[model samples]
Target: MTIVVAYADTPPGHAAVTAAVAESRGGEAVVIVPAVRDERVPDVAELEGRWPELAGRVEVERGDLGDPSDTVIQVSQRLDARLVVLGLRARTPVGKLVFGSTAQRILLDATCPVLAVKPSVAGP
Candidate 1:
């Protein structure tokens, strides 16, 4: 099974992608970009440009538009992924309370083990 990665093109997303690549060790690394209803899908080229290392190493799947957590879960199940990797970003209590937490939902709902990583303070 492949390793599923949830990417948003953010710092935390970058961290997750990097971690997944390292963990893949030449295995499959499937990158899933979540798309909410009516929201435009992220540009794959831009993403690849931002992270050159992913060009040949990662397989990106910009799934149908929907809630991020749902998209991640669905992709993982469809792929029968062994693991789901996600990036965690620091958020204020109020922000989390108001915005709700995609990470929280993914963690609680995913069938396989989920790996959550934060950007290293030392920098990339």
Candidate 2:
């Protein structure tokens, strides 16, 4: 079984990756799908450089779909992934209503189980 990650370049995104690694049972492929718009997707080498434990086990999948939510769902369904992980950032109710929530869409649409994580808050 494989794990699918909705990746973005943010603290929440990093936390999701960390959570995915912890959830892995060794030898399960961790596939990353870029989950932010207008952001460059990190190369596999860059990902490995950031997370040494992901070396030789991480794969980036840029799905053909346009929307980030659609891409994540499409890739997860295509891979028949065992799990889909994504990070959630706090959003105001107005923001959610106006911009809509990619995380919410993924949670509702994904064929496999979705794990939503938030970044750890720093202590004062």
Candidate 3:
């Protein structure tokens, strides 16, 4: 079963991915990082620096942006994914008022079930 986990340069994404894999049917997961324009994607080497500890848990597959929500939805439908996993970042007061969160977008756009996780820690 395909499990698509939304990844960012944050602990939430990593923790969310871990949670998703644990709850999945012990299948390989594809980690997707939506890289917009030419610079938004996080350096993979840095991402993997710590993730190697959990590397055995999944098969990572990154996705560069073509619209994060749209891309995730398409990937889900095409892969027939069992679940689309993503972390719901704590929205800032201004952010909540201005733009919606990616987690919300994914939840609404994905055809399959979406698992949203929020990590215990966060970054500024």
Q: Pick the candidate with the highest lDDT.
A: 2
Local accuracy by lDDT, each model: 0.76, 0.93, 0.65
Q: Candidate 2, clashing residue pairs?
A: none
Q: What are the RMSDs of all candidates, in order?
A: 3.0, 0.8, 3.9
Winner on lDDT between 1 and 3 is: 1
| lDDT of candidate 2 over 1-124, digit per residue (tens) | 8999999999999999999998988888899998987668789999989888889999999988889999999999998999999999999999999999999999999999999999999999
Show the lowest summed lDDT stretch of 10 residues, model 1. Answer: 33-42
On TM-score, the stronger of 1 and 2 is 2
Q: Candidate 3: lDDT over CA atoms?
A: 0.65
Over 51-72, each residue of candidate 3 has an lDDT whose tens digit, in order, gives 5533544444545545766676
Off by over 4 Å in 3: 27-65, 122-124
Q: What is the TM-score of each candidate against the true structure?
A: 0.79, 0.97, 0.70
Give the total clashing residue pairs for model 1.
1
Q: Which residue pairs show collisions in model 3?
A: none
The alpha-carbon root-mean-square deviation between model 3 and the true structure, to one decimal in Å, is: 3.9
Candidate 2 least-lDDT 10 residues: 33-42
Q: Give one digit per residue, the lDDT tens place, for model 1 in 1-124.
A: 5888877667787788788877775546556555233444356576567656556645667566368788888888888988899999999999999999989988999999999999988856
